[model samples]
Target: MSTLSADLAHQPGPETVAEGLLTMLAVVPVCLLVAGYGRGVQELWARRGAGQIVPPWRVAAFGVGVLTVLAAEQGPAHELAESSFAGHMTQHMLFLLVAGPLLAAGGAGLPLTLAAPVPLRRLLARWRVTPAVRRLRRPTTYALLAGGGQSIVLWFWHLPEPYTAAVDHPVTHTAEHLCFLAAAWSFWAPVLGPPRHRAPAPVAVLALVGTMLPASALGAVLTLAPAPVYPARVFGADPLADQQLAGLLMWAPMDLVVLVVTLTVFLRWLRQLDRDRPAGLPRTATLPGTAAVPASAATEGERR
Candidate 1:
């Protein structure tokens, strides 16, 4: 045990004690910001006579999720950063999949939009209706940015030196997280809807599922591999277990979120279609003799 302690001491930068302090500094502010901003929005909306339409519980959950992530990455959880690949995976998963979705679900984006100054909101509204926004509104663009970008960042950061180096450098570490969060937000944008841009439900669903595949495969591969893929262990502590945990976190929970979001988008679309259909039209099929039936229908029926 003494020797193990000595080795852990020699392993890299500061001791866990100092790292924990730094971690708190980073995470606490983020949690407070999210929570405070959410509250402010609710207050603002209430003043406008919107009531408590935005679910306070969801906002609270989102703030909690962010806090949970911060705690995991910084506090007692800082050991995970130094420990194994699996631990790192857990951190990434929580940040990207769990916390990210909760934040988005809390209506953070829209509320922030609402919270902006009236002039800014007007500008945003105008921009939203513009041709440029229309082009970007496509589900394909959201999928590519959210799913494809995330996959790329995940794989790129896993490269041995870079991964280790990121932990040592604050900027890179922050950037890594920002990438994950951004990707998650983009991927989920379509499902949650009211996007500055919009797309058909089917298309958004396809994009969500399609983007998830590569990330899932990557996680599976990492989880099953016997040896650690990163060299951080050479100078640091155990890497194998951390890597595995990271993989599992990436694969399971993230996939589940994707599935849930996809179903949500699909169900919402179906409901919209139901609402939009002409009042008298049958829900299941078009009128028999309408243009939908085709011009050759009568001749075919007479011949029969």
Candidate 2:
């Protein structure tokens, strides 16, 4: 029979254990923030309208955010962080896909804004009314920040040194999480359209589908590569296995979710447009001036 000492020897060492604990410590504040903000927003929305309740999507989003943070801090996330390229990939997917959309749908930003002190809130509101803030509030800016920024971070950070550097430095690690969250928010913003930064329905749908391409391509490249791209290989395990798993995690489900949401938003927008069209006019002529007689008597007579 194998001795207890041999079994203990096979387990992960003290340094790895300490690293995992630190990772959990890092994740706590973000989780608390999400929970507190989510609860506050739900309550605020509930109070604003009679007989209306928090939507299921909002609840799901909040759950996703909390769970993702928990996973990152406690469960497979710690192992993945310490393990191979695949673990890191999986972490990215959770951050981008699971936590990203949920936080967006949950209106975490608005709540965070509301949670600020009164003076800060006043300042923010004032700033938001300014030209610069108005311009930044455009759908294009939201889409880029949520979609393009995420893709850029995902691709840029995969290079060898930066990935390792992130692991070695706590600040960079936090920044990495922030980037993921921001990108996820950006990706989801078009789909859910948070209050201050809503996009046109069509543009929102397009942005959602367009953003997933980069992650898919990157995943495929990593999956097929003959050699590892990241330098800090895991010591006591199979690096390639972790890499393949991470690639699949990053590529497959995230794209699927994006596609499904895009279809849903497109159909919903089409239905809304159809419902709003006037009864007598051709759908194509529903534009304001085209559908109505001009105020001028001469123009009205000419139409008749």
Q: What are the lDDT figures for the candidates, one per model?
A: 0.68, 0.71
Name the top TM-score candidate.
Answer: 2
Each candidate's TM vs. the true structure?
0.72, 0.76
TM-score of 2: 0.76
lDDT by residue (tens digit), candidate 2, 77-195 = 75766666666666777777777777677766666776667899899889989998788778877665666777788887876677777877666766777777777767776567454
What's model 1's TM-score? 0.72
Error of 1 at 217 (Å): 2.1
Q: Pick the candidate with the highest lDDT.
A: 2
Off by over 4 Å in 2: 1-28, 31-39, 42-60, 232-236, 278-304
lDDT of 1 by residue, 165-202 (tens): 77776667766777777676666655553454455677
